[model samples]
Every structure is written in structure tokens, then in C-alpha cells.
Target: MSSPEHKQKIWKMIKDIKVGMLVTLDNGVPRARPMHLVQDEYDGTLWFFTRRSAEKVFETAGDQDVCLSFSDQEEGVYVSLSGKADLTDDRELIEKYWNPFIAAWFHDGKDDPDVALLEIKVQMGEHWKAKESKTFQLYEIAKANVKKDATPNLGENEKFGG
Candidate 1:
């Protein structure tokens, strides 16, 4: 099990990254698509809205294993989440995560029968975050080169599991 601190760190790194690359296997071939993250609280589960007839739905049905990647290059934060995906038609959850922006895609709004929720129960996650500013990073590089020292510390790299 992941510690609360680790989970919180993971959430903090990904919260601002609204878009994630959801990777699913299509007949043994890996396929990835950008998905909008719907939930704020992590709690080891991530939710995404999609259509019932989407290729990802069929792909996930065949194999539940999935990967979600979130990156913010400016902030130098990257997170990779591995999990199992389950498709659900639960209206309550759909409504909970629904927003006007998402409604544009569903045509019929919250009542759209084709609306499906991809519930990704996260099993494990790895994260890399750079704590220093870009300018500071450049300074470190220069200092390392001038002094022939090892590279400077580059924030954190961690792994967590639920």
C-alpha cells in the first residue's frame, strides 16, 4: 500500500495536468489517446468520460490493463500510472464528473446513453519532479561543468502503489 504522503504527492503533481495520455492495448498493439481527467481527488482511482462505442472501450473490454501518463514539461513533472480499467454506465458518477465542456462531446448532455465512464483503479505509479527553476537548472549545469562535479540534485523520483 502507498503511504498517504506519497499518494498526496502524486495527486499534487497530477492535479494541474488536466489531460493525460490513456494507453490501452488494441490487439497486442499499444494505443494512446489524450483524455481529460474528471476527478480532483485521487484516492487510487482515476475517472475519464468516453463513449460506449469508442474503440478504447472495446480494447479495454478485451484487456483491462491500462496506463495513464501525465506530464507538465514546464513544471518538469511527469507521472505514469498503471491500472485496470472498468467501464461503467453509472449515471450518478457521470453526473458527478460532468461539466459543460464535457456536455459538448455527449450531444445529449448528462442523459446521453452512449456516455460511459472509464474507472481506472490505479495499481502502481511512478513520478519524476524537478524542484528547481529552469534558470537554476542552467546554473547547476554550468557549475557542474566548471567544477567538474556530479550533476546537481533534480528533485524527486518516486514509486507508489495502492
Candidate 2:
């Protein structure tokens, strides 16, 4: 696990890597999909979007135990957010983070029947060697050489952007 300072840097890296590839299991089969996260300040909820018919929708249904992976290629930082997924159609939340680009996903834009929200309540995660523990230039050399297991262990229910 990382020291307090390193943990802070990892949090920031997670915030930067907002777009995660969510991994789920469907009938004992594994699946991965790229997802965009919307940070909610009200309840500190993590919000994501997807189509109703997507495979993830089915997999995340019976059980939301899933993994969200984010990485920074340049900085060599990786984060894995493991959590349980939940489906919701919260109108207020949809309106709060609604973007015009989302229109393409919904015929009703904000009211599309096929649109649904996937909320991942974080459990625990792992983060790679970030720059906080070393000089900005030297961290990469050290991190690249470190083994995956030795990188860092981030414990349960950690939040980012605050």
C-alpha cells in the first residue's frame, strides 16, 4: 500500500482518468466496456451511463460486483476500482450531468426509455506507483521497474476529487 502522500496522488490520478473500462461477468463470462463517469457532489455517488440492452446491463443486474480500471500511460499510474453496480433512472441525476452528446444515445434526449444509469459503489482498489513518492522525472523509472503486486494497495471505499 502507498503512504498517505502517495495515496493522495493516486486519488488525483483517478480523477484525471475519469473514463474507465468497466469489467463485468455475464453468466460466468467476462466482459469489458468503456464508460464515462459523472461525479456527484450531492451524495458522493459515482454515476455512469449505458444502453438498456448492453451486455453490461445484464451482467451487472444479478450482481454488481465489477471492476473499473483507469490508467495514465504517460505517468504510468493505474487504478482498479472494484464495486457493486446498481441500475437507476434518476431524473434529477440525469438532468444534473446531462450533456448534449448524450442526445445521440436517447431519442428523448433526457427521457429516453433505453437510457439507464449505472452506479458503482466502490469497494476497494489498487493503484500503481505514482510520482508522489519520488521526483517527477525519476518516478517513472522506478515505477516501471516495480512489480505489479508491490505497486500499492488502496483499501475500501476511497473517494476522489475531494
Q: Which lDDT tens digits does candidate 2 get at residues 64-117?
A: 788888987666677876778998888897787788666666767777787888
Candidate 1 regions with alpha-carbon error over 4 angstroms: 141-149
RMSD of 1: 1.9
Compose the digit string of candidate 1's lDDT tens values, residues 3-108. Answer: 7777788889899989999999999999999999889787888899999999999999999999999999899999999999999999889879999888889888
Which candidate number would show the highest TM-score if scored against the true structure? 1
TM-score of 2: 0.71
The C-alpha TM-scores of every prediction are: 0.90, 0.71
Say what the RMSD of model 2 is: 6.5
